[model samples]
Target: MLYRVSVSFHKNYLTIKNDSIEIGIMEKPVKGKANAVIVKQIAKHLGVSKSKVRIIAGEKSQDKIIEVMS
Candidate 1:
């Protein structure tokens, strides 16, 4: 399954509305920390492994295309 997610960083809390996912993380965007958290959270939310979720595009942008392998 593939999902399109619109992400917002530095929010007060993490939320998922429709195809959008807002995450609140203290980690900076440097060194791919924030992206890591996004993948982990998405995997947990979808009941999948972290390895199963991959960001196919928009790696440095808020709008991302994710591929989820079942």
Candidate 2:
């Protein structure tokens, strides 16, 4: 399924809020500069594989699209 996420990127953290669903989490992106680190951290929290989470769109922008497998 596809999940639409509204993201807020901070200097050291990222908060994603989904209004349509009931999910809540404010996460730190990473200490370093790799985008992969943020992705991995979120995937781990969601109990999904790293490969299953992707910034399908808006990699550079705040709002993003994420696909989670069944």
Candidate 3:
């Protein structure tokens, strides 16, 4: 499955609506830290492993595209 994600910093939250997700992450967008958290959170929410979640686009931006393998 693929999802369109909008990320927010300094807050911790995860919401799913249709094909898009709104994620409020506490980590800063530096050195892949925030991205890693994004993957982890989404995986947990979807009942999948971190390895099954991948950010395929928008690594440096708030909006991202992620792929999850079932």
Tell me, by lDDT, which candidate is best. 3
Residue lDDT tens for model 2, 1-70 = 6666555544344444562212233444444334465567667767889888776775654455667664
For lDDT, candidate 1 versus 3, the one ahead is 3
Cα miss at 10, model 2 (Å)?
A: 3.2
Question: Candidate 3 at 67: error in angstroms?
Answer: 0.4
Clashing pairs in 1: none
Worst 10 residues of 1 by lDDT: 8-17
Best by TM-score: 3
Query: Cα deviation of 48 in candidate 2 (Å)?
Result: 1.4
Each prediction's total of clashing residue pairs, residues at least 3 apart in sequence or on different chains, is 0, 0, 0
Model 2, stretches more than 4 Å misplaced?
11-34
* Residue-level lDDT tens digits of model 3 in 1-70: 8999999888889999998999999898889999999999999999999999999999999999999999
Which should have the higher lDDT, number 1 or number 2?
1
lDDT of 1 by residue, 1-70 (tens): 6777777666635667666665666567887887898888888988999999999998898788888899
Q: How big is the positional error of residue 28 in model 3, measured in Å on the Cα after superposition?
A: 0.8
**What RMSD, rounded to one decimal, does every model reach?**
2.0, 5.2, 0.6
